[model samples]
Target: MLEDLLLQGAQPNYADNIRAIAARWEALIPPARLGDLESGDLQAGIVSILESGEVTDDVILTIAGDLASLSWWRGPPLRDDHRARLNALTRARLTRLADSLEMAPRKLPRSQLRRSHVLLVGNLLDPLHSPSGGAIDYAAALASDTAVSRVEIVHSGEVLPAMRTYIEARLGGFPASRGVALVSTRDNPDFLADILSRGPCTFHVWCEPALSPAISLVSRLGPTLMFTCADEAPVQFADVYWYFQSEAHIEKVWKAHAAPQEFIDRYVRILALPSPEPRPLEPMSRASIGLPEDAFVIATVGNRLGVEMDEAYITGIELALRSQPKAVWMVVGGLPDYLLGAFEQVLGDRFLHVPFSRELDRLMTTVDLFANPFRAGGGNSANIAVGAGAAVLSLSRGDVSSLVPDSFIASDPEEYFRYLGFLMDSPELLAAVKAEQGQHNARMRDQGLFLKEIQGLVRLAADRYEARGCGAPLSTTVFAPLTRLAQAG
Candidate 1:
């Protein structure tokens, strides 16, 4: 019934949502039929259900689902007119029912969270969750904190085996040992109740159009935060922060998105990650990717998608290859044919593409200089290569700039070439650059530092919820976009 309207780009209207509620209720509860009460009659029928005082599972769902949808209006007016139309007394009665149903929360008893029963929500379980690197780091960072009672994940229902391997290797013991649950339910319909059961969630779902109904449900939880993993998001919330790639480089991005200044002022940065053991830099050669031992290899990796950065990345590589006789480029991740063709014209046997690797550290070990793609940028791959003591020549343009060091992240395209040219001109400079970045990488790996930030964010969330007063009827998509009016019963 709702499909035709939704296909034409309509936000769910009152009639549309009421139809769904009536349909579902009728389907679920046969004997207690919603007879002819489909659209305009739904409000009265719903009110009558409460009057009967014999609530069943289906009845409560019909109420809760309707209320959640009722909360979906986004506007300058903030509150919904449909909700406001009811008399104050009727509104109070509805609010009380919501409170009783646990659809609207109140203050969390101190015992309820206990540092937290954490729920880390994200879209994918592959690659430790963030290709730009926060998900992997934050998971480890949250685990490293002794104060955080548990570490669980709500992914898009697919738990790759490598994710378990990464957790076990990085955190010692996981899933079983710590009772670290992986609630694989990012977009699942049945996941709402399970998520509501877990307090203090950190969702990787950001200010984007793809915000799932389940995610919107979690937003109503007192302690929830939206973490951005991409450059653009169509929607935002009151309690939103980002996956910090750099400590001091997010201003441009926040501005680009027209994020509220108040939100930006109180914004949290990316938490640090424990430095994974670097691939040994000693006697480095091209043997890992089966290249000649004598080659001066420059590598770039990750899902280097989108065509915007193709020109810059190819040009940087070609310049280096042309200048240095033995210089070759090894790339991983699926590159577009145009990028490959661009390389072939200027760099024949000098350019090679490696298949995607689960153990990306192995690929980093082969890179003498890592050239990060321009527009799409890098975070996870950049972290690994730099941590592995590989010298990196990264983009100054995009989100990748925030993920890399300012000292190394070049603002000028010329900087990428200059650094690559310097290394090509004097091979001796390579060791010193690696030595410097390795020291920086070691400081970044501090477990205590990462844990402190994670614990602080966790504690701050609980504290903020407390200060704001718990279970303060949250708006689903934005703050006060639609309020469920409460009238005295």
Candidate 2:
């Protein structure tokens, strides 16, 4: 029924049809079955609607939100063509929305005013979720900085009891004068805008579908930075764009979006946030996790292992384990039933599946090698594995895994497998890799240095904004220095 409505495109009752399709989609698809649907048909349907030229902004927003949700829940598309088309269409709609709005000229901050406060806007600020972890870490880092006076997080979701407690504990670790607060507006864009307007602070926007309504407003408020999280293309309205992937990847996204060269040169910046500090954990033994103490443990950790785990990754693990009788596979994250069944059928007693846990640090202590699959995400987990003193082996791809040292990154799947075999066969080589990883982590985890870099960037942005002249159109000229600064970092 949904497909039929979508295929019909703009009908006499197009709005009603769209609403009905949304209702049915929500009713039929639960969270676990997000990946079960055939996205090709859905993508085609969405494209049809987009090209029909009769869709309203509200319906366009709905389609954009749905696409984002699918991307997040189902992982990145295996192929880029569909995603590219969808992004282009979505970008066009958003551009139209922005142009249609009669937005007031952006107000620049007073030169004498110190840029001490920062407002982080996002869909959810839950500390437990893997996607929100980077935002939380960024907030924590800002709070810890002496120069920053306050950190205000405006989120549009529920702050559950557990999440609030965790946030309190995490942010409370900083100085008492830092003044960190989480405000829940429950999807109220006007209220969110009011909060932003009330202060002269820098805004950091985390990319999420729920925050779609506020994007136009937020972009015009002071010096706004968009953290794309390596999931979507950078929204054009942001003054500064932050991404976890390499600069090359940023260029590719901008080119795909057909962004002007000047805009790309000025707004795009790589995320240079400090690596997370290793959390202290109680000693965990192999027996505690139901693994053999004598077996060599090779583990992979991620939040969405079901989406990330392909046949090749699973089969590689199976072959590796079969070749070495003493090898064991420990997967620490959520997995679909099919994947869980495959591991169970192949490895049986040798397979250890641990659900997403707070004790990942402890689990890493028991592992001999951290095997990272070739996927777009999982940089955070890979970094955690590195910080925990475990040797990480991953492909030399962009995303967070690029943070891994060059020596340990595999150029291809064959090299990845060969490296895995070599590490498993040689304990000394693995130990050396772990030592090098420790040195890399030490450099990356320098909070003081990282904080200084952030402060400098903020000042640069402020300077550029001021140079644009009062009530004048935003200039691309001032952004050149930022490009140099980002490259240097």
Best by TM-score: 2
Clashes of 1: 9
Worst 10 residues of 1 by lDDT: 73-82
For model 2, the superposed segments whose C-alpha errors exceed 4 Å read 1-40, 75-79, 96-107, 110-114, 173-179, 187-189, 207-211, 253-263, 267-277, 466-489
- Give per-residue CA lDDT, model 1, range 164-234, as digits (tens): 66655665654343435556654565665665565544433422222234443444465655565434322
Predict model 2's lDDT versus the native: 0.63
Query: What are the C-alpha RMSDs, in order, of all predicted structures?
Result: 11.9, 7.5
Model 1 TM-score relative to the real fold: 0.67
Which lDDT value does model 2 have at 238?
Answer: 57
- lDDT string for model 2 (1-489, tens) is 444433232222134544565575555444333333334466655555544555555555566566554444553442355555555455444544443545455556544224445555555546546546656667787787665666777776776676667666667687756767776666564565566455667766654453264554444445656666543455445566655456676677667655446446555443355445656766688788788889989999876566566778878888999888999999987776667787898779889898767767777888888888777667767777777778888876656555666776887888888899999999899899999987876676777766666665566656655555321322223233333322322
